[model samples]
Target: MLMKATVSGSDVKTGGIALHNLQKRYGNAIAVDDVSLSISPGEFISLLGPSGSGKTTSLMMIAGFETPDSGQILLDGKDITRLPPHRRELGVIFQNYALFPHMTVAENVAYPLRMRRMAKVEVEKRVGHILDQVHLGALASRYPHQMSGGQQQRVAIARALVFDPPVLLLDEPLGALDKKLREHLRNEIKTLHKEVGKTMIYVTHDQDEALSMSDRVAVMHEGRIRQVSAPKDIYRRPADLFVAGFVGEVNLVPVKLKSGTVHGPASENLPAPEWQEADRDATLCVRPEHLHLKTSPPGSSGGLQGRISGMTFVGDATIFQFRSETGLELLSKVLNVLPETMPGVGDPCVASWAANDATILTE
Candidate 1:
């Protein structure tokens, strides 16, 4: 069991990190471009995106690890863009544990405290307290080699928190762990954040991790943030095509807006409700999970026909890849337990998705 709640004040009582017109360019190649965001104190914000999308670069700027070509980084309304990383007073846990192999877990966790020239008794007390907090008290005397990857990561986290820094920065901290272990640690990390109540900036390319752990996620793309919102909002209503495609599996269908109604690729095949007048050139974004696979009632409105191209069972649901009669590729997700027989490959299937499930986007 973990330690019960303690009424220690906010870890980063200094209002949190802010970036204004942040830009980083490496010889004409823009790494992070004109990004402005403010992370609130005690909030866990994740920079999420695919590789080379500027998520890590932005996090590095926040951590004072990377120099921005232009812009201001403010911590608690005070500029810290030119400050050295150590003077920023933030805790950081890197991808590679970065623990000395020769050092015991206790020693590793105590190093930060020792650097501050803290008293021996105080260091021991704090180290012991944090070891217990990370559930590594039993292995305190063991070296990194003697511990599992997960255990070593716990030690790294304990070390980061040992100094009680105002903010925490995690850069792909769970990337080295296996899927199940990673998922387990994800929850543990969130719980730790709540327990510590420290402002955290997490960087990762994994959408699931970002969606599950963040208070708010900023989706980066091509060196700029595409969208920043809560997980459900980001998934359900993405701001643009990039976000819709990046956040999850989505099918993009070419749509033409005529008379305020969106027509499918097979124009006028499906009757859709009239859309707003401003929806011209809109593309429909539909998630596989929202598509319903069923037999078509004769001439049912807003229904389309497709043939099952492939089906894959994925634990809780079956994914159906359908090739529409209109030559469009689509997918549907059906719950595993339902008796509604899944259409086999090459079988004719009627696929229908709610008009509301599809998001209309231009460009």
Candidate 2:
């Protein structure tokens, strides 16, 4: 019987990574601006953004693939900004997997150790250890072409870890797989991180992946980091307009701030934002799930009159869009469990939420 390979929490090498005011430019375009980040030892951080948003460029610079125009990158307290890619001692996994086609899984995993000229016996020992660790011991002799995508991916990751590099950088490692496989691999990667305890930097445009796996997510846009925070905080308490709008679904309603409240576009009074100054134009940001929709306006302050416009059946829940009597559109998410209680489109309803659920973006 084959068993999954094991690694003790103490078995993996660990390192801290820091990027100090990193800047990179290509011709007149700035790929990464003066971005400084301090990542803790063994923490998993994701550089997340859309295309041309500088996340990938920052990762490449950390890996020594792209030279920065200015600033520095430190690994375990040493500057490696100018070091060549191979000399930086970093393990990298690309979207393509990058496994040599003709090589057996064992050969592919062992190639890094062999390159260092380790004794053949030691190389064999290390290869066997990692093959078991990744649960690929039985398929050691099989070539890349003979394995499923997930298996090939496992082989690629095993190759990266076999050499015991202190830092692991993954660029869209799960971009190619189907949803089910991607979800499985994500759990595997998270488990691997716990066992190995090495600093891991992952780059991806997938919000779900970043939010689900990372210890912290650095949201990047327009060559700058918009916000860096834990997954829940990034979604619930974004720092600015861009970050609030980018990370997830939020209903943006224009409002003008007063001494103690936000006057909505529909001339309704909503809760005052804790952070806004008096008399400023702002947008009231509230996520759909935070809004409660009812058939009639609530007995008191929580309710805001609205008419249901449309709804969408998102796999886990239904999202309903409502137009307030003042002509402002807002959204509410209702779970699918209650068929009788669920409101239909065009139904007259009231949208209500707690004052704390809203963030007023004055900028």
Candidate 3:
């Protein structure tokens, strides 16, 4: 259970951030290019991309650790582009838990308050309250060396919260933990966000973290944001080819659009993009899960006829690789229940999906 901490006044309604044309460059190389985004108060937004996509660099600029070459950083409509990190009054958590080795959990959590010259009694009270809130009350006396990675991360979170800042910036806070622990901590962090209601700007390269935890995800690529949308929209209705291909495992099929129809390998007269021009080339994006597989006659008419070229059982789901009669490869994912019903390798199958399940990408 996490406790809510006040910032300024009870009715302040703080934690809105806006980045306007923020750009950063390293000599001739552009790290961030014309990036702009507005986050609502108490919204949990994730900057998601592969490494060097400028997610971390954008976070650093917001934290005041890195100055932008051009543009502005505004918190609640006030420009803080040139403010120092400590003066920005923002809570920041790094991938590495940057706790002092010699400090105990309680002392570490109290460091922010101490640095502010808070009275000793108030610091001790806040430390005790936050430790208990993070379920670290019993480990208050444990030094960093005596704690596990997960516990150390909790200490970092508690420290960040102890000061009760309006906004929290997390840069891959769980990147150092093992998979199981990372998943567990992800839930805890989500719960913390709800309990505290602080605006959270999370930077992560992990799609699962962004998809599962964020209210909206800003997908970045090549130092620019490709798309900003809710997780479902980001996955289902990606804005472009880059966003479709980056967010998930997708099968991109080259096709031609003519007279309100789509023509592709082993497929014709399929759905066409409502806004796309006719008689042009486009790509079809479909996720493996959307493609359904069923044993069918060699010459199926309703769907593409294919042979199961390969099959892989991945715990909860099985992945089936299908080779269409036209030699186009497609993948289908099916739940593992009733394994006897699944098609075997080399079996004739029909792969199909609803028209709406596929997206047409012009680029």
The candidate maximizing lDDT is 3
Q: Write the per-residue lDDT of candidate 3 for residues 1-363, one digit (tens) a residue.
A: 111112222223478888888899999999998888878899999999998999999999999999999988888778889999999999999999799998889989999999999999999999999898889999999999998998999999999999999899999999988999999999999998998899999999999999999999999987888888899999998888888878988878888887677888655565435534688888988899998888887766767777999988899998899998889899888886477787789999887788889999887
How many angstroms is residue 3 displaced in model 2 relative to the true structure, after the best TM-score fit?
A: 45
Model 2, backbone clash pairs (residues 3+ apart or across chains), number: 1
Score residue 267 of candidate 2 by CA lDDT: 58
Best by TM-score: 3
Over the stretch 188-244, how does candidate 2's per-residue lDDT look in tens digits? 999989988888999999898999999999899988888888999889877778887
Better of 1 and 3 by lDDT: 3
Instruction: Give candidate 2 regions above 4 Å deviation.
Output: 1-14, 272-276, 297-302
lDDT of 3: 0.87
TM-score winner between candidates 2 and 3:
3
Candidate order by lDDT, decreasing, is 3, 2, 1
Tens digits of per-residue lDDT for model 1 on 1-363? Answer: 011111222222464777878899888789998888878889999999889988888888888999999988888777889999989878998999899998999999999899899999999999999999998998999999999889999999999999988789999999988999999999999999999898989999999999999999999888888888889988988889889989989988888887677778777544344476643777788889988777554455456666788888889988889887789998887777464565668877677777778787776
Clashes of each: 1, 1, 0
Deviating ranges (above 4 Å) for candidate 1: 1-15, 269-274, 297-301, 337-340
Candidate order by decreasing TM-score? 3, 2, 1
